[model samples]
Structure formats: structure tokens, C-alpha cells
Target: MSFVAIDFETASGYHPCSVGIVTVENGQIVDEFVTLIQPPNNSYNPHTIQVHGIHPRDTQYAKDFGEVFPEIQKRLQNQIVVAHNENFDRNVLIKSMALHGLHYEDLNIPNRWECTLKIYRSKGFKPAKLSDCCRVMNIALNHHEALSDARACAYLYLLR
Candidate 1:
């Protein structure tokens, strides 16, 4: 089966500032994409930067979420989207889209998406934190970076 693993690092609240996608086909990674996004109002919180290390300057000239939504939609629409934490990433996508005047219902996204953290927990793993799961499973992880986190989630899903 083929699927896409996704992750987003937000600038503040639920505003996605960066996105990462890893496409897997027949158990092999087929493609990957990552980009910094200029969020609505170009706003960001200091704490958010501490988590993901993305600064406003980094996305100053980057495309806004509206401009990047088409590419994101193309990758995720009608596909199984896997993320470490579906709630956060999914909400980020929804909120960011709304901020750009796009409606989540209009995106044609799958109603059910996969969460690696949930999968790990279901397998009796107590610590489902992405880095912890990666360590236990011997998967390399770069923690907070969106693309690295997405690739790690893909690897964990592949192992499962």
C-alpha cells in the first residue's frame, strides 16, 4: 500500500509555518517535500521557534499557506496521511487553511488519517513521543524538524 507521511511545525497557535511530506509506495519512500510557509500576518511566537527553530526571517519571503495549499492538497487529497500526532497536524492544516480563506471541507482530505503515536501506543509502547519511539525502534529521528519528523513517522509506519 502507498501513503504519505506528513508533519507541520507551527509558528504560533495552530498556524503552520512549515510542512513536510514523505510519500511511500510499496514500502519504499518515493518522494519527499518540505517548505517554509509565510503564515497569515507573518506572526510567530518565541516559544514556537524554540521548539522548531523556525524564525520569521526564514519564512519572510516564503509563499503563504494559500499559495502552498495546492501542493499540499495534491499530496494529501484522497490519500492516507500519516503523522506522529494527527490531532496537531490535522488541526494546523485546518486552521491554517481557514486563515487563508480556504475551507477544510472543500479540500477533499480523507476523514481518517493515521497517527504513528497512536499506533505505537496500541502496540504496548508506553512512551509514544516521536523521539522516544524512534529510539526504541532504532529509527533515526531529527525530532522537531518537520521533514525529519515526517520521515521518521514513515519509517515507524513501515516497520509496523
Candidate 2:
């Protein structure tokens, strides 16, 4: 019943432009952390921008991954992590950390985070995308915004 639910919105190629973390303890949400990140070279892919609506200018003044690593590490280290799509979010964390010369192993978290998508799918939820699952469960969602997505994912995990 205790875990951190995470969501990442990428600028390009697994480079996180924004991250959201919601910490739950004793089945209650205790903390919510969210920040926009300036991706490498402040670059963004047009297609990704279309999905997340985060333009280059939005994060131009934000901290890069290395600058934000301490905050992320403190929240995630040795914690059970959950995500809507575990693979994508985990890969984003891994690749982003690698880009900043940080090691993912240092977090001491699990190799595979809890996945709401898989859980819902196995429970017979059709079209188990975050938005679809949210709709079925009446969980409010703002789609690709990282914090909203994380919050929704957290609620879905709680319900599951």
C-alpha cells in the first residue's frame, strides 16, 4: 500500500522533459513532486511535443536532469515505484540518468516497477491505456501532463 507512482513526459528519445512523483504511505498520498526539465541541448521532437504539448520554450529555463537528480534520487531511492506503463517510464529514468552520467543502480529500487497498465489489462480492462483505465474507473486525468498522469496512475494502482 506504500509506493511512489511516477510519470515522465519526454522531450525527445526518452529524454524526460517533465517528471511527476506521487508518494503513498499507509495507503494515503503523502507527497507530490513535479518539475519540468530542460532536456539535453534543450532539444525536443515535434511528435513528442504533439503528445505532451511541451514545447522547447516551456522547459528552456528549467533544470536539466543532472541538476534535478538529487531531488529525484531522494524520493525514489529504496522506494517501491509504480507507473502506468512501467517499461516506458523506467527506460526514461534509465536513459535520462545515463545521459547525465548518473547510475540507475544507485537508486536501489526494483529493476521493474509496478505497472498499472499490465495490472488493469490482466484484470480484463480493455484498451488499458492510462486514459482508458482512468475513464473506466472514473479517475480524473489530464492525459499527457506528467503530474496528472502520475496522480491518475496512483489512483488506479490503489483501486487495483
Q: Which candidate has the top score in TM-score? A: 2
TM-score to native of every candidate shown? 0.95, 0.98
Which residue pairs collide in model 2, if any?
none
lDDT of each: 0.90, 0.94
Residues 75-108 of candidate 2 have per-residue lDDT tens digits of 9999999999999999999988898889999999
Give lDDT for model 1: 0.90
Candidate 1 residue lDDT tens string, 80-123: 88999998899888888777788887767676589999999999
Q: How far does residue 70 in candidate 2 sit from its true spot (Å)?
A: 0.9
Q: After superposition, how far is residue 69 of candidate 2 from its true place, in Å?
A: 1.0
